[model samples]
Target: METRRVIFFLFDQVHLMDLAGAVTVFYESGCCGQPYELRYVSPYPQAGVSCGLSFTNLEPLEAVTITSSDILMLAGMDLSKWNHADDMKWIPWVQAAAATGATVCSVCTAAFALAVAGLLDGRPCTTHWGYTAALQEHFPKAQVLENRLFVQSDNIFTSAGISTGIDLALYLVEQDHGPAFAYKVAKDMVIYIRRDGAATQQSVHLQHRQHINHQVHQVQDYIAHHLPEKITIDDLAALVFSSSRNLTRLFKTVTGITIGQYIKELRQEKALQLLKEGHKLSWVAQSSGISSQGELRLLAKQAGRGRLA
Candidate 1:
């Protein structure tokens, strides 16, 4: 078997979780035990990567002249301070690397780097939810999705914040090894194998309401306002002056998901964002109105896994 070279591009202020999660997932899957080579490369050779807490092994990017690699991964970086000079400096190199037919990926806010390099233009991609609006504003040609855990179009993959990188890695593990192997790896890791973008975010309540009829909107709004309450579809429909059947169809059409699915997704997403913000897992579930811890785990799993390539 030919070994696949996976290069992780790192920089200062890179999110340590994003890089380490991916490395851990791939390493634990036994891919590194066989035909898989993983290495860390940086813009400056020998400069240690200060990811949150500790230094990470990093090689210089300029040290290698070859553009060919099985995969190139751009780890999370704080792009708020990124400059045009930085873009001009690496565009040619990035473009050349992509021309080699290697799969390219970005984790969390690292999608900003890919977009600045013009690699995400017209591609279906995602980034950390906090940056989704800015990413769309910066790269209008790119279709930016805020609620997705990851988006895979062509050979380029972009995932949401932090731990979502592990999901993306596990997704790749599934593609290369098969579902059974992927399941085993996920099981061993005590992680979920299936995740989806049907998950929610802050603007989801208003977003869904705006797309549907006024009655449907009222019901959705009511649901959002009363999430902790035991509100049913029938109850929601009555509040909207409609039958449950009509409400269900409208909900599905407007959001491309059933009412229950939408509610669950919204609750899950909020729970996750809260958890990432350092809210205790127990508190996140309680505050988000999700009753079950197992349910939260399933949602986290759903929010983590993304497209497989």
Candidate 2:
């Protein structure tokens, strides 16, 4: 198996987590049987980062070579104080990498660097919410989306603020391997495998899970794994040795949704996933525990109408 190279472009005052988060995803992605070679390149021999930290053993950006099979990531930094003249030298390198078909991406304000390289022109991109207007003002050709976790325009990807870098990295992993493999990595990391860039600020799975009820969580886990099973309040109550009525009350109190509603939402989500993967409507309906295609359509309509809430 050929190893893919992930080159991280480091610069002065770079956000450490933005750099480390994506690196960690690729590092752990080796479990999928494809190893990745991680390299950190910078315009300088050494680069000082935020929070009084510095990185050594960095390769010079001019010395690195990127290929089509490789990925180039630019870490976010203090864009307001960025010295455009000093960093303009790296623009050609970024353009060269992109021209070679390398997947180029940026986290947060790093989109500014990519824009300066002329790679974001006419592309759907996003940066930190606070900098979205500024990015649009500077790069008039780029379509800057607001509130998106990340945006992918062909091989060029740009992510929202700091922590969304991890989300973007996991997404890249999903693109490389598959959703199942990405889910495994996310489980190991104890983070939700967020949906694609079109999703809102938070995922449905992450939003309703911020509670401390063990029994409720157990029920949720069971529902998630058994989406195709005909689950009832009695069955769920039996799992946690509680009464149906009490479980219903606790589930609503904890998750802000009734058990039936949660099950319906889960089934609809699963149906959408199956459909996205090219499954037949009947098969998706069966697999997602919906009674029939008509019912799935009803659920889809409700979702589209925002009536599921």
Instruction: Judging by lDDT against the true structure, name the best candidate.
Output: 2
C-alpha lDDT (0 to 100) for residue 92 of candidate 1: 72
- What is candidate 1's CA lDDT for residue 45? 42
Alpha-carbon TM-score of each model against the true structure? 0.59, 0.79
lDDT of 1 by residue, 3-99 (tens): 6677887755667788888887777777434346777776644333344454545666665453454678888876644444645555676677787
lDDT of each: 0.71, 0.82
Q: Which number leads on TM-score?
A: 2
User: Candidate 1 regions off by >4 Å?
Assistant: 31-35, 46-57, 65-69, 81-84, 197-309
Report the CA-based lDDT of candidate 1 relative to the real structure: 0.71
Worst 10 residues of 2 by lDDT: 300-309
- Clashing pairs counted in every model: 1, 0
